[model samples]
Target: MIIRKDNLLLLPEVYLIIASIFYWVNTSTLFNPFAIIFIGVLLYQVIIKNKIAGLLISSVFILLNLYMVLALISELSEFTTSNNSFIRLLVFGVLFLGLNLIASIFMFKKHLVK
Candidate 1:
């Protein structure tokens, strides 16, 4: 049976929730870059798959990622006593963007296959 949009949408949210829990427990920079890709994935699901649920999910993803990025940059500025945090953030940001692009490409390929 085809999966319902409601159920499909939950998958990425669940991933984000788990990541959030891990971040909280570790106390290691709350907004690690993977979260942005999660937002992009959710957006792809909503936009490409035409799921109505994606509208709300995409909005949340956009807002959350924006806040996270801003907060991360602000914290990096405060932590400027050492450049390590800034470097790490830059590396992770690039990695996240790369991963998001790759995932988007794969998703597009899958769409073409079907």
Candidate 2:
């Protein structure tokens, strides 16, 4: 289908909305699915298209994935924490993921507008 330039804003906005809801709801898993898909797409861009922007975003995506995986593993293993610090970390991680996704949106917009 045709993707309008203005409509392109919806991609990042949707990510922002989901992240906001997860943060407000005291949940941290919302970004993981998006991260997984993003990682694959970034890799495709890097390997097939040799896109320079994909390199940086892919690195950021991996870091975000690492944080999520660690948090998940700790929770799954019943690792105890004195406070809800891990939850906070997860929230921050999701925030960064959203920010990076937002940045990628701008980068894409730049190329598309050119």
Q: Residue pairs in steric clash, candidate 1?
A: none
lDDT, each prediction: 0.54, 0.54
Model 2 agreement with the true structure over 13-99: per-residue lDDT tens digits: 345345445544564564566545554554455345443554455455446646766775666456376357767766765666657
Clashing pairs in 2: none
Candidate 1 residue-wise lDDT, 55-105, digit = tens: 445455546556666766776677646677678887786565344333434
Residue-pair clashes per candidate, as listed? 0, 0
Model 2 is weakest, by summed lDDT over 10 consecutive residues, at 9-18
